[model samples]
Target: MCASACYEIGCALGDAPTRGTLALMLAGLLWYVGFIVVASILVSFGAVDSTRRPGYRRRDGKQEGTLMWPSLVMTAVVAASFAASHYSLT
Candidate 1:
């Protein structure tokens, strides 16, 4: 998903944009969107609500200075992508 978002946004805002890059970026965006929609449909129709185990709520589960998993993932994805884009020097 982050890759998808990165492609969709990066291509639009990149320097020396070309038709090929735009097309490729759009294609990547479409592919990711398709993946998500298909997964949603499959889950809604065929997947079961199988909760293996209830979440174990613990004391001190969160820390003030700690980032959540999703936040961490997003940050990593964006940082990696930004680095890749800027470092490419294309």
Candidate 2:
């Protein structure tokens, strides 16, 4: 996904963007948007909820629940995307 966006941006900076490049850019944008939409759908459908800390177990009698993984994944995704969008070699 990142590669698609990067290539799209790089192509856009050229003198005259070709049809192929334009298609690539469109595809990249679609892929990026698709990911976000799918992710949101997954979250709403409880894909994220499954990763959330489970309820207390009644064997050794310990109540330990933490929503660390979901938080971390979300944070990392956002951070990586932000960095990619703002990245440059200027």
Best-matching candidate per lDDT = 2
lDDT of 2 at 34: 63
Which consecutive 10 residues in model 1 have the weakest lDDT in total?
45-54
Off by over 4 Å in 2: 1-16, 46-90
Candidate 2 clashing pairs, residues 3+ apart or interchain: none
lDDT (10s digit) by residue, model 1, range 51-70: 23234323555323222444
Candidate 1: global Cα-lDDT? Answer: 0.50
Model 1, which residues run further than 4 Å from truth?
2-16, 49-90
Let me know the TM-score candidate 1 reaches against the reference structure: 0.39
- The CA lDDT at 62 in model 2 is 57
Q: State the lDDT of candidate 2 residue by residue for 1-90, as single tens digits.
A: 444555555555453347765565555556556666755665664654444354544356553334545646765775576465435310
> lDDT per model, in order?
0.50, 0.53
Q: Least lDDT summed over 10 consecutive residues: which range in candidate 2?
A: 81-90
* Cα shift from native, residue 70, model 1 (Å): 22
